[model samples]
Target: MPASRNKKNLQVQRSDHTTIWYTVSGPAEGPTLVLIHGWACNRGDFDAVTDHLPANYRVLAIDLAEHGESRSTRDVWTMEEFARDVAAVLEAESVDTAVVAGHSLGGAVAVEVGRLLPDNVSHVVALDSLTYLSLFPAQSQEQTAAMVHMFREDFAAGVRGLVEGGSPAGFDSALKNSYFEKMVAVRQPAGLRSIEGLVHWDMDAALRETKQPITVFAVRAFATQEAIDRYGDRFDIVLVDLGSHHFPVEAPEGTAKLLASVTTE
Candidate 1:
């Protein structure tokens, strides 16, 4: 994996003992790009992607609360709370303008971040996120209960289900196992609570409040036409033949180019 050059690791302390660990690189005055990783993943996943990004662009790869080196004792795990974690970073760094990009669950956070900082975030990007109607939309009472029960009954199995859902047909078994292992290892209560928060998230409400232009880079094999028809008017959904849901890791250069396309414009 290619490593980003001149990377500096930093942390911001938020209320309730929450600490967000992030990496910053490139000139401080350059156009800003904030990279948020998906659930159960960390900022390190974007190390290669950052390496491939334009050298003059300022990049910040963040590990959301309790996901990586960042630790939190807070009880709230809602997407809005997660967005505050990113906001804290922006406030700490004094970033006035930025293109916020997130992968999977991070995509949801990106939307919330845009809502929270209406003036600061110029655009929102979702890497293989938001298009999944099953996951993105808020579920009914019964649906939310059942989904939460499924994960509560057997957490590892729930994690496995997510991994399987993201892996398209003929995906490498060893690779799948790698993802499973890494995801299943996510810190305890936060791991389970975050899933609950995601299923309960009101993406439509967030979209309505967020005024920024949104773009989604979806996996060609996994994206459903139904999703396109539903969100096409709202999001600029572009399909790509990336490896899997975790394509940012599999195809960093391509991911960087896609992100650059948005930031450069």
Candidate 2:
């Protein structure tokens, strides 16, 4: 009829200074699945997996502040800020008792959302994420300044370098291009550098709280058996060996099957 009203037709709103863009799919009367994308990525990351879910399950993916079709502000973007935006979207949608699915940076936000809405969030799924990232800081003040300067001048290049190189075991060429394109589209020059301002937060205790049932589908490179055992108390951690960090892009069937088990079972 009207192009079937794809996500392109969805609306967006500003909540407490952050802009959240979201789209809904599947049966209206079903448990909601709220998705959050990693840094520099958008809701479209979940396009493949959502379709494999049972028809009765509804899917929702949101753009974190400063990423995708959202707002970029002067303030730093903390995990807490990301969580607050998701909580606001939940309120706006009148959604209650949803399963949260997140990737990379989005995984951290999902943890915060679980903490924020303990009663309403039933479960969480973190894919190819970390409690601490693989990136490092410069050893000297001068180096730090250069890092910030480079980011300010060409934010896209800075992000590209991180994604296309030095990323131990996350993605290959095609998947890397897909992820990079999203980052280039969503990230702003000055604000992209704000990552330096965002403190390195440790969520071990927060994750261990295990407010509700949780699961993790991590990349083999980062999600070592040791790490899994350590975090297993909070989540039924599982690792996939086939794909790099961008497992969803290359191994959609496998990823979808894992999520479907938790969602349907």
Model 1 lDDT per residue over 1-265, tens place = 5554799999999976799999999999999999999999999999999999988989999999999899999999999999999999999999999999999999999999999999999999999999988888998999999989999999889989999999999999999999999999999799999999999999999999999999999999889999999889998999999798999999999999999999988
The lDDT, on a scale of 0 to 1, for candidate 2 is 0.67
lDDT of all predictions: 0.95, 0.67
Best by lDDT: 1
Candidate 2: segments with Cα more than 4 A from true spot? 1-9, 131-158, 164-174, 189-194, 197-199, 208-210
lDDT of 2 at 41: 68
Candidate 2 RMSD to the correct structure? 4.5
Query: Against the true structure, what is each candidate's TM-score?
Result: 0.98, 0.79
Error of 2 at 83 (Å): 1.1
Instruction: Give me the candidate number with maximum TM-score.
Output: 1
Residue 89 of model 2 has an lDDT of 78
